[model samples]
Target chain A: MKRIEKVADMAKTSRILAAEGKSIGFVPTMGYLHDGHLALVREAGKENDVVIMSIFVNPAQFGPGEDFESYPRDLERDAALAEKAGVDILFHPSPEEMYPEESDIRILPGRQADVLCGASRPGHFDGVLKVLTKLFHLTRPERAYFGQKDAQQLAIIETFVRNYNFPLEIRRVATVREEDGLAKSSRNVRLTPEERKEAPAIYAALKDGARMLRESGDPELVLGMVRNSLGRIPDAEADYAEILDYPSLRPLSAESGEAIIAAAVRFSGARLIDNILVPLEGKTS
Target chain B: MKRIEKVADMAKTSRILAAEGKSIGFVPTMGYLHDGHLALVREAGKENDVVIMSIFVNPAQFGPGEDFESYPRDLERDAALAEKAGVDILFHPSPEEMYPEESDIRILPGRQADVLCGASRPGHFDGVLKVLTKLFHLTRPERAYFGQKDAQQLAIIETFVRNYNFPLEIRRVATVREEDGLAKSSRNVRLTPEERKEAPAIYAALKDGARMLRESGDPELVLGMVRNSLGRIPDAEADYAEILDYPSLRPLSAESGEAIIAAAVRFSGARLIDNILVPLEGKTS
Candidate 1:
């Protein structure tokens, strides 16, 4: 696989491929590739003539107290995994290369960004949108792959693309998980031994909440069950457990068409989040 | 020239051209074409394989009391002028067509937007940037053209394109003017006969300011001369007359290498703005 380290070279390469009528599928990621990231690359390879995976741990997306400095990265290991997963190109750019100067323009995400993860982490989605805007323009992919594990991010990206009229499709792959139902995440390794063992409850609570959403009509009841499920865990502290309408991320009413049961739990040193989409009575995905 | 009225059709047409390796040059304007608009179209025609002129009186750019409702528009006249100027396509989308819903994402322009015309028309640059973002994505131009008559807008756009890493060049066309030296503007027609007679003084003041900048190094002195020059016009009310550094639009200093003299003056019912770029000792444009 060809590895590109410069923005200009990547843009030129993508332009040449575009001129030749080749559809490019891109999977943008921060390094330390896992099965979840590889799953996106595999899906991209199946759909497009060229598949590119970018590894840049963007500092813009991290707040002051966030683990930007300690974010896991292993370039050589990621390169090997990406190559084995059938990635045609690997774009690895240094922070200096990606951002030569501070950005003058700042993107403010809409109302959807004011709740859940957005409420706790201010300017997070704005940074995500900013980096994605740069990456999208640089790569100009025909389709971009994103894992559903970051569902709020996925929804915001979809809205941004639709609102901005970016000529690309956002293909969402399902969240890859472990045998114990815990969602696979880069932060998983940061968990202490005890925290790691108890982290599965985060996803378990989300699953139970999804079932409650499907069977019951009351949003508050569903949320209470979710909070109670997380409360049962020995050392788990619920950060936010709520049921909101999908995509819009607005408060869910009894008549709300579709919903997402999402929760974030704090355990010792690690913070874990999980979500499940529940289609309403007659709806099917 | 082919006229497109729908956003989807324009995007599809542009995509087909892109796939055929054709470079598109775009000129985005609020309708009621003048010599200034035609000059941009002409320049775009010279540089690109396909030239597209989009006439959209973007409501997003106008404040509540602004002339958005009374903004001059003559589709038939514009279409004729565009065809005579060798435009390959004319995209005339309705306000509803451009913005089906209130935008979820609103672009906040940087520091450059807080002065000059931006001070009088709040949120104007934000609206301009927002519409341009949408149009740039939909049209996917190789280069976009803008006249220097709106120098502040041009400066902000240049900074925005640079900051966001947009994949296109901004080709600036010299401000086209009437024989008597009044910069051509669609708003010029709104001036009363007496107001129109005094309007050329705006440009005359800018020219004098440019000369003062070349001869003297003091920005405050140059601005005082510019304001006095406009002050001489019978019914003119000088809105703002200042000298600032080029591109950055920051306050100018003796050490500042290049500069721009910009002013906005209200004459009866019309508001007219003009500017001149001054290159330092060894620099030439």
Candidate 2:
């Protein structure tokens, strides 16, 4: 349960761990720890000799109009939760520490980044990739843990690791949700009471679409139904609703191996996104 | 010397080397194996327990009209030279091995990469930085060496390592030269017989500019003298001849610590460049 700030300090600590033949498992987060983040920490604790969780609410990832200033941060609470989850180290660096100098270098995705979240928030994934790259270099983890809640992010990270030939393994944890089917997110606290009431509709739409896709072999029809369901929610503005191939984020023609029914909707000025994978119906082991 | 082509092989080798507590020294070169590259290898061999050299004629660094296809390469000769220089490994990866998938991630330098060779070759430094970044990640060298002949390239790599917080040390090997003062380069093989005869003028002009700056501390006056000196060579066409800050490469005005007389000249359709640093006269040790 040690806390560190400087990049050099963290790198030195990680190097010692690596020198001792200990495999490091890392979970990079933007603080405001929820069960989802804790899930990743727990997974890392199980898999590696040492687990590190970095809390950096990276300014690079937020778009100009996005809620960067209002992004939730609770370092003390996060540290306690991470310690409970058996994290060995908490890397909590300030923005100035994380980005000592402005970077013009960016990591952009191929066709995958041009659609969905990328289109909605330009330069967002580039920022994400940039911080992830820096953290990866600093940590040099044997395995890195990421939650499936950020499914597209996980996919892009996997692509980045493969494409860059990064010497690390990536482990994706399942999306942690609340009893109300709401995905655990720091931004969830920003939702107004009315917005909170309507927020679950986004997830409901995804669930409905995935169930329909599993029952019927029509992707377009299921997507349309999800759109219509989201459209009917009070003040809920659907950014996009599509059933896409797992990981690639490419739009799928029909229900293939494991298709993702993903959607982003704006409710009371807060953009909420959710997704559920529709498992292949007749492929039980 | 052991030669590895695949990134996986290099990573495996690096892991074993790390386990043995051996420091890896890396020299990344576009093979034509001249004295300049060997100088770097010699430096690496002296400083590190394990010396690794990569001979990749990166296609990404060449512009549309540049000599990418004709970039001289002789792996057998390079392997022998590396072995002679006591290199432990020579990584000779194919373009496919390095770039298995097309790269959309570009490492754009903020201030350093947009001038000189960068201006002449768009997306050139992005390619250079990307490939070098990949190499750094794969090799995880204790220190990496680059010749000061490509001053701009050296500056870019320095800035990258600092900004990205890469753990490797950077060593700038002094520029190696031919007997006639021509900077040693693989591209020197591409020069026609007449071009070869006139290539010395590039260095001559640089030396003249350095002499002028040392004798008289006026950058403008030094530049004029160098320009006129290059103008004397009948076959040589001056591209840019200016006195600037040694490391930053910004145009100089007042007396500075170390100033460079950097110039690029086109001789017989082959662009040649050279620079010499002049410590300000009367500066105390």
Candidate 3:
């Protein structure tokens, strides 16, 4: 795979590809690639003549006292994974190259970013939207792949593309997981062995909530049962757990037809978040 | 010349031209086709294989009490003028097409937008930046043209392009004028007959400021004299008459090398603004 660094170089290469009438698919990520990232790449590689991936540990997405400086980065391994996944170009730009000057203009996604992760970490989605827009413009890709693990981000990006009339298709891929049902995340590497054992508890709680909704058909009862069960896991602190509308990420009522069982837990200082989409009466895609 | 009323159709045409290895130049305007706009179109047409002009009186750029609804628009006349100026395509999207939903994403240029026109109308530059970004992405032009009459706007757009890494060149064309020396603008239609007669005072003030700087070589004396002269016009109120550094748009001192005299005035409920760039003793271009 070809590795590019400068934004100018990437734009020039994409210009030539566009001139040749070739379609490009893009997958943007922070380093330390996992199964979820690989799944996005495979989906992008299947639909376009060229597949491009970007690995940027964006500082704007992290808040104060967050993991901005100590975020895990393994370029050698990440590049190998991307190449095996059929990526044609891997863009690895340094912080200086990506943000040469201070940015005064920020892209805010109205009410869409006013809840969920946006509510918890202020200005986080603003950073994501900025970098995503820059990458999208630089690559001019025909399609972009995003995983369901970041469902809120995917929804905000969808609003961005529609509101700005961006000429690209956004494909949402299913969330990938480990054999033990723990959602794959680079942050999972930071968990201690004991915390790792309890990390699966978060996913288990989500599954329990989903299963209860499918069986009892009461979202409130399912949420209360999962909340009570998650509190019993020793050394695990539940940050937030609730039933929300699938893609909208809004709090769902007990009478809602479809909902997502989402939860965030703090285990050994590493925050783990997971969710499962389940229908109250019918199946949710 | 081909005329497209829908953004989607224009984008399709732009995409086809890009695929054919043609360089596209863009000129975005708010219709009514003044000499200044024609000058920009001619300049863009000369340098590009295909030239596209968009006439959108973006509502977001106007304040709640500003003249968004009364903004002058004549698509038929604008199309003829664009065609005469050798424009290849004219993109005229309606309000609904441009903004299907309310966009909360505001592109505010903090310090750069907090002066001059921005001072009088809050949130004005944010709207300009947002719409300009959308237009830039939709056209994907190799070069975009803007009249230097709106000097601060040109400066903000330059910074936006650099900070965002937009792979497009920005060309600043000289301000076009009428025989009476008043700068060409659609807002000129808002001036009463008597107010129209005195409208040239805005340009006169800029020229007077430029001449004083050239003769006395004292930035303070030049700015004071211009402010005094503009204060003399009847029914014309001077908003601000300051000399600032070129490109940066910051207030310049007597020791500064390069400066630009920018001013804004209001007469008969019509706000008028203009600027003139002066190369200092040591500065060139």
Q: Candidate 3, residues B131-240: lDDT per residue as tens digits? A: 88888878889999999999989988998888777878899999999899999988898899999998898888889889888888888888888889899888899988
**Which scores higher on lDDT, 2 or 3?**
3
DockQ, ranked from best to worst? 1, 3, 2
Off by over 4 Å in 3: A215-217, A253-258, A280-285, B253-257, B282-285
Candidate 2 vs candidate 3: the TM-score winner is 3
In candidate 2, how many clashes are counted?
Answer: 0
What's the DockQ for every one of the candidates? Answer: 0.72, 0.52, 0.64
- Each model's total of backbone clashes: 0, 0, 0
Alpha-carbon lDDT, every model: 0.88, 0.83, 0.85
CA shift at B78, candidate 2, in angstroms? 0.8
Q: CAPRI band of model 2?
A: medium
Report the lDDT of model 2 for residue A158: 90
lDDT by residue for model 2 over A86-172, one digit each (tens)?
Answer: 999999988898898776655666667777788898888889888888898888798999988788788888988887777789998
Pull out the clashing pairs in model 3: none
Specify the highest-DockQ model's number.
1
Interface RMSD values for all candidates: 1.2, 1.9, 1.4
RMSD of 3: 2.2
